[model samples]
Target: MKLLSSEIKNKVLESMVKIIDRERHNIIKANKKDLDAFNREDQALFDRLVVNEAKVDGMIKAIEEVRVQNDPVGNVISDLTLDSGLKITNKTAPFGTILIIYESRPDVTIEAAVLAFKANNKILLKGGKEAINSNLILEQCWHEALVENGLSKDWIKLLHLKREETQEFLRNPSEPLDLIVPRGGERLIKFVKDHASCAVLISGRGNNFLYVAQDANWEKTLKVILNAKTDKISGCNALDKVLINKNIPNYEAKLKELQHVLRRANVNILVDENIGNILSSENKIQEEDTWYEEFLALKIVLAEVSSLDEAVEKINTYSGGHSAAILTEDKNKAAQFMEQVDSAAVYHNASTRFTDGGQMGVGAELAISTDKLHHRGPLGLKQLVTNKYYVFGDGHVRV
Candidate 1:
């Protein structure tokens, strides 16, 4: 694969920023078509599909942010000289081609490609059919920017394939696929992992958990819980399961208070057998699988735990390994919980929603990777490249 200079890539991105800014009305119109055809029953997916003026502005800002960041490729990671006088250097390199399969969120068509292109990687975008019109227009904008900057349209592509066709394509891609990232729910990740012949990175299944210790400030806990749960239910970092200490002062009263607050906000509450006995009016989870579910809606599960160890154990066993939080004033306990939980991101006295890329100061991101191989957090520009070693040796014969 040919490595593009940083200047040319930044030029392409600059062109994209202008093109998207100019075509905001057309983008919104195309999005409106998708909105009219989509069923709003899935509130999360519906939220992701909607693109108004603010979203268009956000897209342009994302491109601009990536355009200014230092190019990720060709940076030397390490330089070494062996005893035999063989000089070796390891340097960052592009992944060649990257395929991102995502559902809704047409902004990804801009953010994902910008980061990949800036790092000198060709990107293939496979968005859900529900957002076809929006994705097509966005792809057109990318193509125009590429052409204006004297680049190939092949650098950024939107694949239009049905479910069966996608499965077959994953099983047998005509071209080499260096990496495939599935950025949606469990079903999408599983489909890609089961069928893809290349490496697949999992993203966006966030059955995030928050543990409220007995010493936690009730006011702070309530505020964090409310914001984490209701701020944006469609977000992958949104809170899903909350475990409260059963020994907390006025534990029963606090539980009732949480129930009232949640009900007032129109958020549905599901409880385990223990919490169900107290909050009998709410729905009770019938199966254990509910613990493993990621509810990307206005729904949350309340479970009671007797100790911090139990909360840590339960979260480790059932969480998506994405994000977890512990709410307590005790620094020691917070440190213990943060160190013990096996997740990509852990929070102390904060909402899990802070696990996002932009919020974490990464600017634009491809996804929130839950995989530990290459990366375990936000997939930012610097995290997109792989390393290669170049060895130079004098002509010598083996002894």
Candidate 2:
């Protein structure tokens, strides 16, 4: 793929912002078709699929934000004149073509494509069939933006492949795929990893954990818990597991109080044996596999940990390596926990919900990557590009 000038890329995004604003009505109408055909049983997914007036406004804002961000490509990372007089520089470069496989969330069609285009990468969106109509309309907007800027429509594409065809395509891509981001559950990540010949970035799992240290402020604990758990059940940054230190003062009373609060909020509780013994009415985690699951719903698991070490160990062992939080008044303990916790984003005295790109000041995001090889955490415009080494050598022969 040829490098696109920053002005050209921004022009496309500018066109996209205007086009999306003008076609807001059409976008919503197409989204309505999807919503009408969709089963609302999966409340989280249904929430993600809906494109209301607010969502349309959000899409326009995303493009506008990406347009203002500096171009990520060609930024020099390191420059040096070697001993042999060879001047070498490592600079950021676009990742040629990227394929993102996501479910629900028609907003991704706007966010992901905008980031990739801004960074000069060709994007191939593989959204779930549930959002076909919504995605098609969004793709049309992208094509129009490209054409309006006199760029090829090939810069952005939405794939309409079935399960079998997708698997085959991953195994044998019709065109080169520089990177593939699987932005859904573990099943989707595994599917891409197992079949895709290119680099695969794991994303969108929310088996996130929050630890309530013994020294934590009880009021703050309850507030963070409620916000992280119920604020946005469909978000990948939403909390799913809570580890309460058993040594906390008035531990038994706190456990009962927490249970009451969650019940009041209508969040289903799944307790481990220790907590189950205390919260007798709540359901026990019957399967160990439940620990590894990302509950993207109004559900949470409450478990008791004897010590901070135990909590850290459990989080690292079972979490999706996305985000983890510790509530502690002791800064030293908080720092220790943050250092030991193995996750993309670690919080101290804060909710895991702050792991979001926009909230964390990264503006619009393509995905919250859980992979460590290339990037971890929010896949923002700056994080979307790879690096290339440019070497300029004299005509002298090697020693």
Candidate 3:
């Protein structure tokens, strides 16, 4: 892969910012076409498909944020000299080419490309058919920026392939795929993993869990739970499960209060047997599979746990390894829960909504990776590059 100078990359980003601003109307108009064609029955998917003026502004902001950040290529990671006069240095390098398959969201077409291009990696976007119009317009904006900066449009591209074609391409990609990121639900991730020949980075599934410990501040716990569950139901960090300690003070009353709060918010609740006895009117979970499901909707499951260990075990077993939180006034207990949750981002008395790249101070991100290899959390500009070693040796031979 050809290395691009930081100046040139930033120039492209600057050009992209201006182009998106100028083409804001066209972008919105194109997105309207997608929204018109989409099925509104899937509220979460529809929410993701909408690209209003605010969404356009968000895209511009994402590009600008990445533009001002430091370039992530060729930075020294480590340097050492052996006794045999051999000098070795490790430096950050781009992953060459990255393919990210995502669903519904058009903003990803902007965020993913900007991050990968700024890091000097070419990006291939395979957005869902539902957002085709939005993605096409966004891809054109990217191309204009690249061309303005004397770079190949191939640096950022959108793949327009059918389902069968995508499957075949993943199995035998026409070009080398240094890495693949499946930024969607379990089915999509599984599809990519089962077919892709390259390294696949798992992301986007979010059956996140939050624990309310016995000593948790009731007011703070309620506030965090409301925001994490409803702030943006379409978000990958949205809370799907809440485990309340059975020994908490006034457990039945608190569960009733929770049911009232959730009902007022119009959030559908599912409960385990223990919680069901208290909130009898609420729906009971029908299958074990629901525990592992990432509901990108206004739905959540409330269950009871006897101890902190049980809470931790349940989250680790059922969560998507995305985000988890604990609400507790006890510092030691909060620390224990945060340490044992085994998610990408574990929080103490904070909402799982904070797992986002922007919220976590990562600016714009490619995805919130759940994969432990290569990277685990936000795939930001700095995290996009792998490491390369350079050796300088003169008249040195290994025995």
lDDT of candidate 3 over 172-220, digit per residue (tens): 9999999998887788999998999999988859999999999889999
Candidate 1 accuracy as TM-score: 0.98
TM-score of 3: 0.99
Estimate TM-scores for all models: 0.98, 0.98, 0.99
TM-score of 2: 0.98
lDDT for each candidate structure? 0.93, 0.93, 0.92
Task: Show pairs that collide, candidate 3.
Answer: none
Deviation from native of the Cα of residue 252 in model 2, angstroms: 1.7
The whole-model C-alpha lDDT of candidate 1 against the native structure comes to 0.93
What is the alpha-carbon lDDT for the whole of candidate 2?
0.93
lDDT tens per residue, model 2, 24-103: 99999999999999999999889999999999999999999999999999999999998889999999999999998999
**Model 3: how far is 188 from its true place, Å?**
0.8
Model 1: pairs clashing at backbone N, Cα or C within 3 Å: none
- Give residue 243's lDDT in candidate 2 (0 to 100): 98
Q: Which RMSD values do the candidates have, in order?
A: 1.0, 1.1, 0.9
